[model samples]
Target: MIVYATHAGGRYLQLKDSLKEQPEGKRGVYVNLTNRCNCSCTFCLRHMKDMAEESSLWLREEPSVELVKDQLESLPWYYVSEIVFCGFGEPTMRLGDLVELLKYVKDIHPEVKTRLNTNGLSDLEYGRNTAVDFAGGILDTVSISLNASNAERYLALTRAKYGLKSYEAMLTFAEECKKYIANVVLTVVEKVENQEEIDRCKKICEARGLRLRVRTYEDK
Candidate 1:
């Protein structure tokens, strides 16, 4: 699906189905731009879930920026609280398109919030400080996967294409985001790591002045 909403059980559903299932409240609308990622995280749902064809976030091909905008335009404004750039893969894999879409959303609906869910390796992917592209308040929140407390453990879990240094680069990207994005969140999945490890992650965030979010196992 190019644009969708999530339901219970971590189910990906069309906006129409989502509304039909639960018709009343505002919810975050997710945009799936591509199915390309820099990391192959062991615990990611992309590897674990078996989704029905119609609702799968795994895109057959990357949607054009105009196509994504068309989907965004079709959304029921009253029911949308936020617009998130997230899919089966890393949104930053299409950085230029991603930024343009962010701007498009704000230009169309300045009041609605916007966010990005990322692996935080855009710097390594682009070999530059890519977070600056979000300047001028086009983006509000950036939730980066903080898979482990240290570089080795992180590499073990994510199998990032950039190798062991991917962890540090991710953290650096998160820190750089603090300058441009309003809310910078570093996340660690609950069941994927032990309490000791989670605590260690919290410390890492604390020392770095970043917020740590312990996501529920089923959270997406």
Candidate 2:
């Protein structure tokens, strides 16, 4: 099935294709928020694909809460098991809108799982504890990127605008997320050298009462 987002709503484009396209048993939907981001990760698919703008997600601009709600309303209930906030860019860039949309979706389909894949810098970005708002909402899981063990390596990987401090900021966000989100995850990109770093990342997650998720590095 083809999941397309537009001003009117999230719509099924042409459903003649394979349904088992996305892994992770996610027969759900993917929502693209905005193309803006605080970091430009070296491994990011945004640089490798055509989804470099909000417009490419078929949005004239960032969708309003009503617009996104309308899209979610049109979705077939059975085909969706989850609703994911993950475009090529940072979903939290449109933090308020994302939260609003999540509330709207949950009101209609409370059983449908909802998730967010982020760089884990929302605290720094929004200057507040954003996780608290997600506590009892549609959000089920939150995946935060922890690319490297050290600040230098993290800076190198993400090329973040926040400098070396972004690593610490991300860890701090993950720590706070544990108190708010039921499933708070710290993810490290897998590579030869990242094995040891991944171990270190696990330790960090463990200390913060969170889980570690090792992601496969695609050579984009």
**What is candidate 1's local distance difference test score?**
0.90
Error of 1 at 38 (Å): 0.6
Model 2 lDDT tens row, 106-211: 8888988888999998888878877787877568889998888789989998999889888998998888777767788888877724567788878877877778
The sequence of per-residue lDDT tens digits that candidate 1 reaches over residues 1-220 is: 8888987778878889999999899999999888788898888776666542444776777788888888888888899999998987789999999999999999999999999999999999899999899999999999999989999999999999989999999999999999998899999999999999999999999999999999989635
* Shift of residue 15 alpha carbon in model 1, Å: 1.2
> How does model 2 fare in lDDT?
0.73
Question: What range of 10 consecutive residues in model 2 has the weakest lDDT sum?
Answer: 6-15
Off by over 4 Å in 2: 1-26, 49-60
TM-score for candidate 1, please give it.
0.96
Best by TM-score: 1
Candidate 1: where is the Cα deviation over 4 Å?
Answer: 51-55
